[model samples]
Target: MLEVCVESVAGIGAAVAGGADRIELCAALAVGGLTPPLSLIRQAASAPIATHLLARPRDGNFRYGAGDAALVAQDITTAAEAGLAGVVIGASDASGRLDADMLAGWVAHARAAGQARGRPLSLTLHRAFDLCPDLFEALETAVHLGFDRILTSGGQPRAADALDTLAALVARADGRIIILPGSGIDTSNVAAILRTGAQEVHASCRSPLGEASEAEQRFGFQNGAALQTDPAKVSALKAMVRRA
Candidate 1:
C-alpha cells in the first residue's frame, strides 16, 4: 500500500480522496513530523479509514531522555484513543543507536491502547532507524521487538538514491520486518523504489498550489493562506504505484 505523510488538515482530505491506502498524520513537516494535537487526530481519524499517527515530540535529532520517551508512550495512548490506525515512533541513544528497550515500552503501550479502543496498533520505526550506530544491528533489534515497519531512505537523502543500500536492508530484514522507503519519494521515483523490492513506500506528494475553503478565507483574511491539500499529486502518486 502507498502511504502519504500528511502535514496539514487539507492534506488529509486530499489523500483520502485520491485513494491513499493509508496516511501518517503529523505536524511540522519542515522539521520532520511532530505529534499532532488530539483534536487534529480526531478530525482526521473521523474520516473512517486507516489514518496512522507519527508520535514524534520534536524535530531536529531523535536522541530522547526518559521524560521524552514517557511522553511518546503517552501519545500512543492519546492517538489510539482518538481512533488513529497506528503510530510512527523512533527513539535513540545519545550516540545514535536504536533504543529498543524504550521502543518496546512504547510499542506495548500502543498495542494496549489499540486493544482498548478497538483499533489497529501498527508501529513504524521512523528515519531514526537510519541513524543507528550499526544499521544491520538496529535492523535486527527492530525485528526482534516486532516493529511493524521501518521508514528509511536506506542511509541517504532519497530512497531512489540509495537503492543499493535499501536492497541490502530488505535482505537483512529477513522477512521479520518491513522496509518502507521514504524521504524524497514522488510520482517520478515511486515505481523505481517499488522495483527495489520493498512492499511499501512513503511520500509527502505535495503540490505547489492547493484548494482553499470559505472558512479559511474568512479567518485567513490578508493571510494569503496556502492550500496544503494537493489532490492532483496524491492521485498521480497513486496511479504511479498502481502501475508498479
Candidate 2:
C-alpha cells in the first residue's frame, strides 16, 4: 500500500488522484509534521482513500509532557469525531524508551472515542520507535499497545540507507504488526525499499514548487524550501508499489 503523507487539502486531492492507498494527514511538513487543523481533518475524512491523522502536538522531540499529552489526546478525539480511519502517534521518555504509560492513555482515549462512533480506529506507531534504544523490544511494546502498524526507517535517517535493518524488522514483526518503511522513499528507490518485505510504504511525494517569495521568506512564512505534493510522483510511486 502507498501511504502518502500530506499537509494540505490540495495534497489530499493529489493523493486520491494518484491512487494512494492511504493518507497520513499532517501539517508543517518542513519540520517533520504537526497536528493538522480541524478543517483539514474533516475534509480528509471525506477523501476517497483512507485518511489517518498524525496526532503530533508539535515538532521537536517526541517526549511529550502532561500538557502535550492532553493536546494529543484532544487531537485523537477530534480525529475520531471527524470520522477518520485512524490516528498515527508516538511518544518516548528521556532515555529513549517507549513511554508505555503515556501511549496507553492515548490508545485508550482513541479507542473510547472510536467506540462512541461505532468504528474502531486504527492505530499506527509513528517514527518515534526509531528513537528507542532497542527496536525489537519497542516493536513488542507497540504490539502490546494495540497498534496496527509502526512507521519506521529501520532506526536510520532514511529507509533506503538501512535495507538490512528494515528486512530484519519485517522478519521480527512476524505479521503481528506491520513494519511500514518510510522516509526518503520515492520512485527512484522504492523497488529496493520494497525488498524489505514491507507491505506498505510512506512518503511525502513532494516536488519543488519553486522559490519562496522574498516577503514570505523575510516574514518567516516560508522556510528554506518550498514544496508541494506532486500527483505525478505519487502516481509513479504507486505504480512501483504495484509492480513490486
Candidate 3:
C-alpha cells in the first residue's frame, strides 16, 4: 500500500486520483508537517480514500510542552469528530526517547473519541521514532502502547539511505506492528524500498507547481513555489508498488 502525504486540497484530489491507498493529511510539509486546520481535516475526510491527520501541534522538535500536549489531544479528538480513518502522532522526551506516557494518553483519548462516534481510530506513531536514541527500544515502546504502525526512516534522514536498518526493523517487527518506511521515497527507489520487506510506503510525490508571485515571496508568506502531488508521479509510484 502507498500512503501519499498531501498538504492541500488539490494534493488530496491528486492523491485520490492517482490511486493512493491512504492519505496523510498535513500542512507545512517543509517544516516536517504540522496539524492541519479543522476545515481541511473535514474536507480531506470527505474524500473516498482513507485519511490520516497529522496531530503535531507545531513543528521544530517532537519534544513538546504541556500546552502542546493539550493541543495534540484536542486535534486527535477533532480528527475523530471529522470521521478520519486515523491520526499520525508522536512525541519524544528530553533525552530524545519515545515518550510512552505522552503517546499513551493521546492514543487513549483518540480511541475514546472514536468509540463515542462508533468507529475505532487507528494510531500511527510518526517519525519521532526516528529521533529516538534506540530504534529497537522505541519500536518496543510503540508496540506496548498499542500503536497500529510506526512511520520511520530507520533512524536515517531517508529510507533509501538506511535500507539495512529498515530491513532490520522490519525483521524485528515480525508483523507485530507495521514499520512504514518514508522520507525521500519515490518511484525511482520505491521498488528497492519495497524489497526491504516493507508492506507499506509513504511519499509526498510533490512537484513544483510554479513560482509564487513576487509579492507573496516578498511578504515571506510562501518560501518557494508551491508544491503539489503530481498525479503522474503518484500513479507511477502506485504502479511500481503493485508490481513489486
Candidate 4:
C-alpha cells in the first residue's frame, strides 16, 4: 500500500486521483509535518481513500509536554468527529524514550472518541519512533500500546538508506504490527524497500514549486522553494508498487 503524505488540499486531490491507498494529512512537510487544520481533515475524510491525520502539535522534536498531550487528545477527538479513518500520533520523554504513559492516554482517548462515533479508529505511531533510544524496545512498546502500524525510516533520513535495519525491524515485528517504511521514497527505489518485506511505503510525491513573484519573494518570510504533490508521480509510484 502506498500512503501519500499530503500538506494541502491540492495534494489531497492528486493523491486520491492517483490511486493512493491512504493519505497522511499534515502541514509544513519541510519541518517534518504538523497537525493540519480541521477543515483540511474534514475535506480529506470526504475522499475515498483512508485518511490518517498527523497529530504532532508542533515541529522540531518528538518529546512533548503535558500541554502538548492535551492538544493531541483534542485533535484525536476532532478527527473522530470528522469521520476520519484514523490518526497518526507519537510522543517521547526528555530522555528520548517512548512516553508510554502519555501514549497510553492518547490511545485511550482515540479509542473513546472512535466509540462515540460508533466506529473504531486506526492508530499509527509516527516517525518519532526513530528518535527512541532503542528501536527494538520501542517496537515492543508500540505493540504493547496497541498501535496498529508504525511509520519509520529505520532511524535513517531515507528508507532506501536503511534497507538492512528496516529488514531487521520487519523481521522483528513478525506480524505483531505493521512496519511502514517512509522518507525519501520514490519510484527509483521503492522496489528495494518492498523487497525488505514491508507491506506499506510512504512518500510525499512532491514537485518543486515554481519561482515566486518578485513582490512575494521580497515580502515572504518563507524560503521561496516549496513542494506540492504531483499526481503523475503518485500514479507512477503506485504502478511500480503494483508490479513489485
Candidate 5:
C-alpha cells in the first residue's frame, strides 16, 4: 500500500486524487510531525482513503512524561472519536529502548476508545523505532504491543540507504506486523526501497510551493520555503508500487 503523510486539508485531497492507499495526517511537517488539531482530524475522518493521525504531542524526543503521555492519550481518543481509521505513535526510554510499559498503556487506551466507538483503531509504531538500541528487539516489542505496523527507515536516515536492514526487518516481522519503510522516499528511489520487501511505503510527496510572505518571515512565523503535497508524485509512486 502507498501511504502519503500530509500536513493539510489540501494534502488530503491530493492523496485521494493520487490514489494513495492511506494518509498519515499530521501538522508542522518541518519538525518531522506534530499532532494535528481536532479540527484537522475531523476533516480527515471524511477523507475517502484510510487516515491515521500522527499522535505526537511535541517536536523533540519520543520520551513522554505524565503531561505528554496524557496529551497523546487524548489525541488517540480524539482520533477514534473523530472516526479516523487509526493513530500513529511511539515512545522510548532514556536508554533508547522502546518504552514497552508506556506503549502498552497507550495501546490499551486506544483499543478501549475504539471499542467504545464500535470501530477498531489501527495502531502504527512510528519512527521512534529507529532510535532503539536494538531494532529487531524493538520490532518484537511492537508486535507484542498489538501494533498493526511499524514505520521505520531500518534505523537509518533514509530507507534507500539501508536496504539490507529494511529487508531484515521485513523478514523478521514475518507477517506478524507490517514493516513500512519511510523517510527520504520519493519516485526516484521508491522502487529500490520497495525491493526491501516492505508491503507498504510512506512519503511526504511534497514539492515546493513558495516562500512565506516577507512579513510572515520577518516575524519568525515562517521558515525557509513552503511545500505542498504533489498528487503527480503520489500517483507516480503508487504506480511503481503496483509494478513492483
Candidate 6:
C-alpha cells in the first residue's frame, strides 16, 4: 500500500482522486513540514480521507525545545478534534539520537490526547528516524513505544543515496513495524524505492506553489515563488509503486 502523503488541499484532492491510500497533512512543507490549518483538516475529512497530521512546528533539525514540544502536543489535540486518523512526527536530541525519554513522554501524550474519544490512533515517527544515531536502535524504540510506522530516507539525501540503509531498516523492522521509505521519491525512481522493501511510500504531489486565484492576488497573499509539488509526479510515483 503506497501512501502518498501530501501537504496541501490541492494535493490532498489529487491524491484521493488518484486512489491514494492515505495522506499526511501539513503546512509549509518548504521547511520540511508544520502543523496544517484546522480548516484544512476539516476539508480533508469531509472528502473521505485517511488523514495523518504532521506535528512539526519548523524544520532544519529533529530536536526541539520544551515550548516547541508543547506546541506539537497541542497540535495533536487539534488534529484529533478535527477527526484525523493519526500524526506523522518526530523529536530527537541535538546529536540526532532519539531522546528516548522525551519520545516516550510524547508518545504517551499523543496516544492519550489523540484518541481521547476512542477512535483508532496511528502514529508514524517521521524522517527524523533518518537522522538517528543508529537505525536499528531507533526502530526498536519506535516499536517498543508502539508507533505504527517509521518514515525515513535511509539516512541520506534521498532513497537512492541510502538504498542499503533502507534495506537494513526494512529488514530490522521485520514485520513488527513499517519502514516507509520517503524523500526524493518520484515517478522515475519509485519502483527502485519499492525494491528497497518499503511497504509504503510518501510524496507531496502537486504543482509548484502558486497563487490560489485572482481574488487572492488582489487580496495580496499571492507570491511569485512557486513551491515545489506536482500531481503528475505524484501519479507517476503511484504508477511505479503499483508496478513494483
Which portions of model 2 miss their true places by more than 4 Å?
none
Report the number of clashing residue pairs per model.
0, 0, 0, 0, 0, 5
Give the per-residue lDDT digits (tens) of candidate 5, residues 68-165: 99999999999988999999999999999999999999999999999999999999999999999999999999999899999999998888899999
In model 4, the clashing pairs are none
Alpha-carbon runs more than 4 Å astray in model 6: 209-225
lDDT of 4 by residue, 1-244 (tens): 9999999999999999888999999998989999999888888988898999999999888888778888999999999999999999999888898899999999999999999999999999999999887999999999999999999999988889999999999999999999999999999999999999999999999998786677776887556766889999999999999888
| Local distance difference test, each candidate | 0.84, 0.94, 0.93, 0.93, 0.94, 0.79
For each candidate, what TM-score against the reference?
Answer: 0.90, 0.98, 0.98, 0.97, 0.98, 0.88
Model 3 alpha-carbon drift over 4 Å, by segment: none
**Model 1 Cα lDDT, one tens digit per residue, 4-35:** 88877788888888888899999877677899
What lDDT is reached at residue 240 by model 3? 95
Q: Mark the 10 consecutive residues where model 4 has the least summed lDDT.
A: 217-226
Return the clash pairs for model 2, or none. none
Q: How far off is residue 217 in model 1, in Å?
A: 19
Model 3 lowest lDDT segment of ten: 56-65
RMSD of each: 3.9, 0.8, 0.8, 1.0, 0.8, 3.2
As a whole number from 0 to 100, the lDDT of residue 134 in candidate 5 is 95
Residue pairs in clash, model 1 = none
Give every collision pair in model 5.
none
In Å, residue 11's CA in model 4 sits off its true spot by: 0.7
